[model samples]
Target: MAQWFTKWIGWVRVIAFFGLLFGLIIRIGDPQPLETLRNASFDFYHQSKPRELTQLPVAIIDVDDTSIEEIGQWPWPRTRVADMVQLATAQGAVAIAFDIVFSEPDRLSPAQIAQDNPDIPPTLLSKLTALPDNDQVLADAFAKSRVIVGQTTVRTIAGNREEKREMAKVAHALIGPSPLPYLLAFPDIVQNLPALEANAAGRGIFNALPDPDGVYRRLPLVMSVQGQIRLGLTPELLRVATGGDPFAVRTNEAGLEGIVLARQLIPTAHDGTVWPYLTPSSRSRYVSAADLLKGRVPQGRLAGHLVLVGTSAIGLEDFRATPLGVAMAGVEVHAQVLENIMAKTLLVRPNYTIAIELVTTFILCTLVIIFAPSLSARLLISLSVVLLAGYVGTSYYLFVGKRVLLDPSFPVLATATAIILISTVNYLREERQRREIRSAFGQYVSPDLVDQLTQDRGTLSLGGESRELTLLFSDVRGFTAIAEEFRDDPEALTMLMNEFLTILSRAIMDQKGTIDKFMGDAVMAFWNAPLDNPDHARAACRAALKMIEDVHAFNAKRRREAARRRKARAGQKRKSAPARRKIHRIKVGIGINTGQCVVGNMGSDMRFDYTALGDPVNVASRLEGQSRYYGASIILGEATARALAETFAIMELDVVRVVGKAVPETIFALFGDETLARAPLFAALCATNSAMLQAYRDRQWDQAESQLAEVSALLDKLKLNMADYVEMYSGRIADLRIAPPPGDWDGVFASTSK
Candidate 1:
C-alpha cells in the first residue's frame, strides 16, 4: 500500500512538471522586442569597433550656410552649381555624391529664363527655359565624374486626398514613401532618373531613422519607393564602387524588410527606416560645408572615401532621442551606412524563433522536476546565470559568424524559471525531508552522516566519516619536463593543464569512478564509495584503457599538425620565429588495484570522508608513479586483472612486490572489455603480442628476441603504427638478457620514486 502511494505521487509530480513546462511555453509570448534587442546588441557589438574609412572613391559636395552666404542665397543658379561639378572633376574627384535634390528648373538665375519673360517670343522663351535646369546642369557636371544623388521620399495619403493634400503629405512620407522619388516636371520621370541612375555611379534614398531608444542600430540594406525599392547608401556605394548594376529594392509593411546578399540570407525588419548604431563617444560624421568650398581639409581625408553629407549644424532640430541622447544630425545617419558596409556588420534574426523558445521551456521545467527541493538557491541561481550567459554569448557568436540574430526571450524565461522552480522546490522538499529523513536514518547512523546519505529514507548519513579507501592516482607522462620547456603565459599553461585533467575525469566517470579531487597536474579518485559501483576493478581498468586509446589519437593528430607547421614555416617571408597555433598534446599514466580493507567513510567527525583503508590502495598509487620507468601507460595488480578478465583485453606486464607486501602480484593492462571484442586493431594487436609473449614466457631468449623482431617487422609492414609501443618492449628484452633473473625471478618491479 505504501509503495503504491509513492508510485502515485511520483506520477503526479511528472504530470505537474509537464504542466509547468506547457504553462511556461504559453507565457513566453512573442519575442519581438527581445529579438529587436538581440539585433541591436549584436549590431552595437559590431559597430563599436574603430571606424576605419574605406578607399572607395567618393566626394561629398555640401550646400552649407557658408556656401549659401558666400555664394548668395540657398537657391544657387543652375549654371553656377554646374560649374562646381566641373571644378570637382577637374580637381580629379572620381565620384561626386550630391546630398541635395533638384526637382524644379532654375527660373530665378540670370542665366535661366527671365521672370518677366511672360510676353517674350514663344519660341525664343521656350528655348531659354528648356536650355537647362539644375538637373541638366548637374547632369553636365556628373558626366565628368561618377555621380550619385540623394533624394528624400515623400508619401501622399490616398482616398482622403480631396480633403487634405497639404497635411496628408506629412503623414504620407512618414507612413510610406511619397511620389517625389519618381516625380519630375516631365513626360517620363522614370526614364530620366533611370538615365541619371545610369549616368552616375549610384543613387540612394535617405529616410526615417529609429527613434529615441537608440535601437534599430543598423541601417536597412535597401529602401522602397512606389513599389520600387532603391538601394541604401552603403550597398549602393558598394555596388557603384564594385561596378555592379543598381539593385532593385522592394518593401513589405515591416519597413526596408530584407536583401539577398550574395548567396546568404540577410533579414531586415524595417520597411524603409535606417537602423543607426549609436556611437559611444563622438557625434555624427558631419563635414562642414564651409570646408568644401575652400579646400582647407587634407586631400586624402575625403579622397576616395565615401563621404556622406549631413547636417550637425546645431539647432537644425533634426535630433530627437537616442540611447546616448538626442541632438543628432540626420546626415550623420548616412555616414553610418557607409561604416556598416565597410565592416559588413549587419544584424539579423533567426528564421525559426518559436522552436528555440519551446526547447528552452521544456528543458527548464524538467530540471526542476528531477532535482530535490533542498538544492541551494545560490547554486540554482548560479547555474541559471551560466545558462543565460551561454545563451546570450552563443547568440552573439552566431550573430558575428552567420549574421543571424537569436531570440533572447527564451533565455530570459529559462533563467526566471530556474530561479522560481528551484526556490519553490527547495522550500517544499526541505520541510518534507527534515522530519522524515532524520527519523528514518538516525537509529543506524549518527546525526551528521544523515545528510550525505540520500539513497533512501533510512539508508545513509551525511558527511562525517573517517574510513580509509583505496586512492588510485593517475597522471600525464613527461608533464614535469613539458612544464619546464613550455614558456607560454602562466594563466594559459594552467588552463591547458586543467583542460587535460577535465578530459581525464570524463574517462574516469565512464568507468563508474568518483573523482575525489584534482591537484594542479594530478587527479586523485576512488570507486565503490560514492555511488557504489562494486565492480570498481573492472571500471578502473576500463577507464585506463580508454585513456590509452585517447592518447594514441592525440599523438597522431599532433604529428600531422607538426608537419603542417613545418610546411607553413617554409612559406613565410622571413623565418625569424615560428607562429604559434593552438594544439593539445600529452601522455598519461594510470594505476589501479583492489583489496579488502577498512571500507567506510573518512573525514572529520563533523566532516569526514567515505573511502577504503588498505595497503592495496597505496600500492596502486605507487604503481601509477612507476609507469614512466616501465614505458607503460598503466600497471595494475593481479586481482584487478582477474576481475576485469571477462570484459577487458589485457597485456601481462611485470608484477610488483613493493615494501611490506607478502608476495609479488601479477600486473596486466586492461585494453578493453566486451565493448571492443572484435575491433581489427585490437585483434591485430592481440595476435601480434601473443606470439612474442609466449616465446618470452618459455624463457627461450633467442627465440623470444626473434619473435619480438618479427612483431615489429610485421607492424612496420602493415604501416599501422597506431601506438608503436613494441619498440619499448624490445628495449626491455635487451635489458633482461644482460641482467639474468634471480632464482625467485618474481616479475614484480618495485617502484621507489615519488
Candidate 2:
C-alpha cells in the first residue's frame, strides 16, 4: 500500500524532527548568572566538546571584558565594594566572591551614613537616616579577608498568597528541626546592615535557576532555610575552603541529598538555584570598584582566589547560558563552583545514572539480536565507536574518578534511543535490500559511515576483509613501447585500455582508494584496512598525487587529440599512416613501501576481491620497476622514505641492492618542493646527498668518491637525473674504492630483494 504510506511519512518526519529539537530546547529561557555565563561561553565553540586542558582550572572573577573594563557599572557602590574587599585581602586571594546583591543601603555617599553612626546628628533625620551606609564600608571589608556574598531566592504558594520578603537573616542563622518544608526567608532585599551580617566570612544564594532549556545543567545544592535545610554559599564556600562545615546539610528522601565537604560528596545537580561561577579574566583577580577605591592593586591578589564581583557591564544584563558561554559571569558560576571543587569536575550523574540507562537499552536489544540482517556500515560504525567510548567513558569515569552524578543526559538519550532502534532496524533493511552498497559507498566512505550503514545492515562484510598490505606501483612511460604501436582493429586497443582504466579508476576512487586489480595499465592501492586508514603513509602519498594529477589530465586530453588529428589531416595524411600519433607524452612511475602485508578476501567464494599482500608488496612492485631508470615520478622505500617525515620533498636517491634484495638502502627522491628544492643547483644536490651519505656510512670510499663526484657534477649542471642511479653510485664507489670495511656504522642499509 504505497509502502505503508511512505513508512508513515518517514515516521512522521522522525517525530517532527525531535519535536523541533524539543521545541528549540524549550525556546531558550532559563538564563541569568551573567546570562548563564555568557551562554556558557556561547556554548564554548558551539555547545560543548572542548574539555581540553585535561579540564580542571575552576577560575572565575569575570564580570568580564576585563571585569567590565576594569570595574565600574552594574551596581558598583558599597563604598566602592569596600575597596574590593581591601584589594582581595591583599591579593594572595583564595576566596573573595559576590555575584552581587548588597541589598540596598549604599545610596552612594550621603556622607557614609555619618561615619556609620558616629554617635550624633548630621541631620535631616540624620541625613534622613542618611544613605551612603555602604554596609559599613562593606562591614569593614567583611572584617578583613575570605569574603563571599550574594543573596536572592524566592519560591512560594500555599494559601492567600503569603509571599512576603524582608531579608537580612544571619543573626543566629540556625534552622535544625528537619521536616523539610521549603523556606529560604529574607529578601525585600535587606541590602546588608546588622554590621554587614556580622563581618561576613561567607554567604551564597546566587540561585542559578535554570531549566526551560537555557541550560545551567544543575547547582541548587541546598534550599530551605528557616524550617530546615540551609547550605548554599557553594556548599558553604567549598566548606570554608576545605576546612569543612560552616553548617552541614543532609536531609533524606533524596531531596537535599548529601552535599559533603571534607567527607567529599560534592558532585552537584543544581535546581534550587546556586549554580553560577566561572573564571579567567586575569590573575590580577577582581580589584576595581575603581581600583579598590584608589588604594590601587596587589595584596597578593586577595589571599586565596574565588574572587568575583558582578555586572560585567554591557549595561549589566549580567549575561547567561553556560557549559562554559553568552559572555560569561554570573560570578563565573561561583567561579565554576570553585573550579568545580578545586578541580574535581563534579559534573557526574551515574548513581547508576538511571541504571546506566537500563543497561544501555539492554545493550541495544543485544545488538539487535547479534547484527540483524548482517551489519556493516563498518560494523555499525565500529559499534558506534564502542558504544560511544563505552558510554562516554563510563560517564567520564563517574565524573573524574568517582566524584559521581553520571546521567549523561539520560545515557545520551538512551544512546540516541538505541541508535534509533538499531537505526530503525537499519532503515528497514536498507529499505528492503535496495543495496547499491549504499549508493556505491556513498561518494566513498563517511556520511557518518553512511548513516551507520543505513542504520545497521546486519554487521556487514559483503565478502571483502583481509590484512597485511603495502602495494603501490604506477606505470605508463612507453606502456610496453606504447602497446607496440596499436595492432590492427585490436578495437583500438580495447577502446584505449577502457579510457585509461576509467581514468585510473576515477583517480583511485577519489583518494578513498581501494583498487587492487588493473595491472595492464598499472594501479594497486593499500592503506590501514579495506576501510580504516590510520593515516596510511598519509593515505599513500595522497593517492600518488592523485594518480599523478590524473596523468597530467590524460596527457592534456591526448594533446588535444593530437592537435585535432594534425588539423584534420592538413594536406591529407597518406591514408591511416599519419594517425601514428596520440602517444601523449608519457610519465606515470610512482612507487611506495611500508610492510606487514595480506589484507582481506581473495577471489572465488563467488569471486571475491578486497586485496593487499606482502614483501612490502613486491617492494612496491620493485619500486615501480625502478621508475624507468630513475627519472622518478615519485618513489619511496627507506620504509616509505622514513615513514613520511615532515610530509614529503625528499632527495637522497639510491644505494641500489635491488633486483631481489641484499640490504643496500639509501634511495629517496619523491622530488621537488622543499619550496623548489632551494635552487642553487638544487642546493648543491642537497649538499652532495648529505656528504655522500656520511661518506657511505663512514666506509669513506674516497669520501664516497668525492661525494659521488659532486653528485655527478650536480646532475650534469641541474638538467637533473644522472641516470641508472649514477652508475649505481659509481659502482658502489668502485666497490668501496677497493675493499673498505666499516666502523660503528648505524646508517642502516638493509634491503636485498622484492
Candidate 3:
C-alpha cells in the first residue's frame, strides 16, 4: 500500500498545475464576478487616496436650488441663459461649455406669448409680436463669446417627426485606423436649435454613461452619433480654449490609443474613454449662477478658467454615483474630467496591464502548487501572506505613484484560492493515510495501540528491531479431522474457522498483543515490539489461558447443539437410510515463550507483515506440538513459565529435547489464574506431583508406582485428564525394572518427532 501511494503522489501536483491554468483562463475571459471584484479594488484605492487637488483650471457654474429659487424655475428663458454666457465672457473666462442642451424653442418669446394670450387687446398683441425673438437674442450672445454648445445622444427618436441634424463646427483628423467601430454609438442626438448651434464656436456631446454598477469611473471622450464621430464636451472646451485646433485622434490595431489636441496627448482606453482621477466635491470649484446673474460674484473669479454651465439642483436628477462612494452632479463630473486632462492626473489602465496580471497569477499559483506539499504548513502560510502583501503593495504604489490602474484583486484572489485548494488536498491525503493505518492494524492490536499509531505516524517503520517479546502459537488439536468432517461443505469449514479465530484473536488483542498471521487453523501472535510492555510474559500467559477457557465453553455449546439435533431426528417417524455422522467438539493447544527476538514488518517492498523471528519463537512452536503428546491443552517454555509461576496455576510438565535442538528445555502446563494457584487443593496436588516426578527420575520403580497412584488420585480430584501421562510413566518404570539402565542415565527425556 505504501509503494502504491509513493508511485502516484506526483499526480496530485500535476492536477493542481492544470487547475491554476484554468483559473488564468477564466481571468482572461473577465466574467462579471471577476470584473466586479477588480472594480471594487480600484474603488478602494480611490477612496483611500483620492486625487489631490492643487490649482483647478476649470470652474462649474451650477444652477443649484438657490439659482432656481432666485432666478425662477429652470429653462428660465434662453434669454436668461444668454445673460449668464455674456456675464461669464465679460469676466474674461477662456472658454465656456454647457452641460445642458436647448433642444426646444423658447415658449417665453414675444411671438409665442402673443399667440398664447389671444384675449389681450389687438393693438398690444401686435406690438408684442413685432419684438425680437428670445432665441435670437441668446444666439447673438453666443456669437459674441467662445461658447461650446452641448448635445446629448438618445437611443431612439421620439414620434415621427423628421429631425434636422447639424454637424459640429470643429474639424476632426485621424492619424491611423478609424475609431468609429470601437466607440459608443447612438441612433440620434438632442441638439440645440439651428440658430443657437450655428452661432456657437464648437459643439460637443455631453453624455456621461455610468458603469454597470451605476458608478461613474470612465467617461467617453469620443463617440459615434448617427455614423459620425463627435468629440465630448470637455475635449471641445480644451480645443476651443486653445485656438480651436483640429482634433487629432490616434489609433492602432487594438483600438483608440489617445487623442492629440493642442500638442498634448490625452491617454484613453480602447473605447476612447478616459479614467478620471477625481477629488471629493469641493465648494471652492463652484460659483452660483444666481450670484453671477445678480452681480454678486466678484470680477476675475472665473477669468482664465474654462467654465461649465450645468444644474446641480436635486430636482434636475443629474447626480451620479462616484468611485469615492459619493454622489456628484453630472456637470461637476465633466468639470473634473477637464481638470484631470489639463493637470495630467488621469488614471490609465494600459493595454498591457492584463498581460502583466495574468503572468503574475500564473507564476505565483504554479509556485504554490509545486512547493505547498513539501514545505511545512506554517512556512507555506507565511509565504502566502508575504506574497499577497507584496502584490497589494505593488498595486497601490502603481496607483498612487504612477497614476496607473493595475488590478490586484484577481491575482491575489487566484493565488490565495490555489493555496487553499492545495492545502486542503494535502490535508485530506494525510487523513486518508491515517485511516488506512488504523484499518490495517486495528484487528492486530488493541484499539488504544492503533489510535496511538494513527496519531503519531513517525513511530512507524518498515524495518526490524531486536527486543524482548512474548510469542504465542495456538492451533486446533485435530484440525485435519475437523476439515474432513466439512470436506463436502467448504463454506461451513470457512465459517467455523472464522468463528474460532475471531474468539482467539479477541483474547490476544484484549491483552494488547499483536497478531502476526493465521495459517490454516493456527494463529501466531507476539507483544512488546511495536509498543513497549514490561508484563508481556504475563499477558501472553493470560491470553493462552483465556483461549483454553473460551474453547471449552465453545465445545460445550456445540455438544448441546449436536445432542439436540440427534434427539430431533430420533423423534421423527421416517426411517433414516444411515446414521448421521457424529459432530466433533473444538479444542485448541496454546504454547507461549519469552525471549529477545527481531520483530518488525517483513516481506517484499510491495507487501509486508509485522512478525517476529528467533530461536525462542521456534521453541514456542515446538512446545505447541508437544502438547498433544503430553495430553495437555497449553504448554509454556522455561522463560515464560518462570515469568508466570507466581501468578498462575502452572505445573512442570517435562524436561525434554525436541526434534530440532540438542539442548533440553523444561516446559510447564498452564491450567488457571492466580485464584486457582492460591487454592489449597492445587497446593496439595503440586506436592504429590513433585514427589512422583522425583521418584521416576531416580529409577526407584516400586516407590515411583506408589507415588504415581497418589498423583492419579489427585489429578482426578482436580478434574484433569492426564491418564496418558501416568500410563506412559508406568510403562517406562516397568521396562526399566525388566532391563536395567546403563550407568549414564539422565532424567531429561528426548522426543524423536516434532
Number of the top lDDT candidate = 3
lDDT rank, highest first?
3, 2, 1
**C-alpha positional error of residue 191 in candidate 2 after TM-score superposition, expressed in Å:** 19
lDDT of 1 by residue, 1-754 (tens): 9999677457536655766766665546644555555445544555544234443343345555455555665566756656665555555554555555555555664334445666777777767666555556567666767666665555543343333211111011122344224221111111123334445656655545453355434455554444444555556555555455434333344343344443322445544333444344243243445555566645545555555544443324444344333344455555555555455554444335556756765675566555534356777667767767777777666655665656555556555765575566657777798779687778889867775565454323433333323346888776766676456666767876766676788888887787876766778777776565666776677677777777677678667977888776664434375556545468787877777656555665477555555777677777787666655677777777667664665666555566556577676655456755456665665666677776665556787777677666655554534233566666667888898777775444564454
Best by TM-score: 3
TM-score for each candidate, following the candidate numbering? 0.46, 0.34, 0.58
All candidates: CA RMSD (Å)? 18.3, 23.8, 29.9
Ranking by TM-score: 3, 1, 2
lDDT of each: 0.57, 0.59, 0.88
List where candidate 2 sits over 4 angstroms from the true fold. Answer: 1-84, 87-140, 143-197, 201-203, 206-216, 219-222, 226-330, 334-512, 515-542, 545-609, 612-668, 673-707, 712-731, 734-736, 739-754
Q: What global local distance difference test value does model 2 have?
A: 0.59
Tally clashes: model 1: 45
Q: Residue-wise lDDT of candidate 3 within 47-133, one digit each (tens)?
A: 999988777778999999888878887879888999999999999999999999988889999999999999989999989999989
Clashes of 2: 106
Where does candidate 3 clash, by residue pair? Answer: none
